[model samples]
Target: MAGALDALWSQYTWALGNGDPRTDSWLLVHSPIPVTLLFVCYLLLVVAGPAVMRCREPLRLVGPLAAYNLGLVVLSGYIFYEMASVCWWCLFSKAIELLDTVFFVLRKKQEQITFLHVYHHSTMLFNWWAGVKFVPGGQAFFVGMLNALVHVFMYLYYGLACLGPRVRCHLWWKRHLTTLQLGQFVAIAVHSSYNLFAECPFPDGFNMAVLLYSLSLILLFLNFYYQTYLKGKQDKLT
Candidate 1:
């Protein structure tokens, strides 16, 4: 069965083929275009979403936001499951995830695309590109799987939050969501750093570009969690 599936998938490689890996294909995958373009779109979202908050209405943002998060939840789950079977699945799934940013752009709901959102989305894309493009299968597959597990609940909560005024009192999982996301980044960073260094003694040559990218994501996520959650708590206490 696996052999037949491999044969079928091989025949369809052209349809799924992305980078060349021979002539600078590696460079192209790690290029800044995807990240820069996504950042610009995200900035516009943050700036514009609040401006139009009055007209757009929080409830109006609920449906699409819910759907988007829910889709990601499922996507993360599938990717994680496939990775467990054939670790390389993380790379394929991450590359496909670049489209999520497009959804954020189209929705014009910048509020949904928070700093954590942008950081997570952008890093995941580049990290996977790095993985598939260079690092084939190492600790990466595990990290990606862990992330997908968390997304299932994260998106569900976000979907509920989108409902606004009619939102159930217990629907608010924002605090826990942020906490989980932070932990996810920290774990990725630690595991990845171990693989990168000889400290953990994992195989080398998986791809340095993405290793760096994942590390940066950890730093940014830590900062974001500190500012968004910790600071918020401090203000509340004050």
Candidate 2:
């Protein structure tokens, strides 16, 4: 049994070594343990955070939330800019994004902590870990760049909305954010699908993974849009 475990561990390390050499020395890319541990901690917090806040008043984080969202807008832009030049930063950005859920928990915005929210946040970390681990650049950069671009606008809206009623009143394109997100998924799916079929240098496996993941996001976001906007409108009219 010990020999078998040793062989399994050797295979895992060999797989890690097979990835982009440029990112081999980079943080969190050396082993899956760091990201896996972070993921586990995120799950633990998701379960424990709200429970811990049950008795306490929800923390008012208007200023900090505004800052956090705006910060991500800047970070996302930087990632878009540096995407082709380096891939590690994009991987690092995923770890930073995990804070989104933490903030939701802290603010006691239980409604915002939906399964879609948790799934998206948690999965991106692992997905990108694999992306950076292997096939760091090439077609993978397309998805990262497009996602970063969408995040710029998305975070800008959220940051402005956090400034209270006056700011939010001007932010009339709230529903449009969901539309934009859906559009992003569509674009990514198309891009990934094309590369999967084309004679591209990027790994077929990664392209397929991206294609499937984007399709899943499309379905989930469509349901969210129906529930939040379309159905809500119908109910209001009734």
Candidate 3:
């Protein structure tokens, strides 16, 4: 059994572009244990966090939430900027991004913590670990850059919305944020699919993984958009 597992692991690593080094730095951050541990903690917190907030009144985390969103904007920007050359930034940024859910849980915004949200965050952690561990560079950085660009706008919107009702009144773009997210997934799917026919150094498995992931997100986000916007509008009209 152990031998079979080892063989499977070896094939998985090869599919992820193991031995392709686009950047050189600390070995510890790229190691599998730390990455796995970080994600495990994130998933545990995802389950435990809301339970802790279950009996408590929702905390109005205006100041902290704003700081958190803006901080991510900066971090995402930096990761996008440095992704082409520095591999550590992607891994570090992904680890820190889990704080997004922590803030949601802290504020008792349970409704915001949807399947799509958890799936997006958890998969990102896992996928980026694979990317950072194996591919770390080349065309693999494209998704990070696009996601970072989307996050800059997404988090900025959230930060402004967190300010209060007055600020949120001007924030008429909430639905558009979902639209942007949908666009991000579409863009990623299209870009990743290009690798199917083109000759690229990036592994085919990585590209296919991205394409499939993006398709899943697209379906989820489309459902969210229809339910949140289209259905809501129709209901009001009826």
Summarize candidate 1's per-residue lDDT along 1-238 as a digit string, tens digits.
Answer: 9999999777545423543343224333444465446556655655565565546533445556667677777776787677745444554455445545545545555555666666666566555654554444555566767777777777677667656667757775777887787687667666666667665434455434445655676677677778867898899999
Model 2 residue 186 lDDT score: 99
Compared with the true structure, all predictions reach lDDT values of 0.60, 0.89, 0.81
Best by lDDT: 2
Q: For residues 108-192, could you state the per-residue lDDT of candidate 2 as single tens digits?
A: 8889999999999999999999988887888888889999999999999989988899888899898999999999999999998
Two-way TM-score contest, 2 vs 3, winner:
2
- Which parts of model 1 have CA positions greater than 4 angstroms off? 1-63, 85-116, 196-215, 236-238
Clashing pairs in 2: none
The full ranking of all candidates by lDDT, starting with the best, is 2, 3, 1
Q: How well does candidate 2 score on lDDT at residue 231?
A: 97
TM-score, one value per model: 0.61, 0.94, 0.87
Instruction: For candidate 1, give the lDDT of residue 222.
Output: 71
- In candidate 1, the residue pairs with backbone N, CA or C atoms under 3 Å apart (3 or more residues apart, or in different chains) clash, namely 134-206, 135-206
lDDT of 3: 0.81
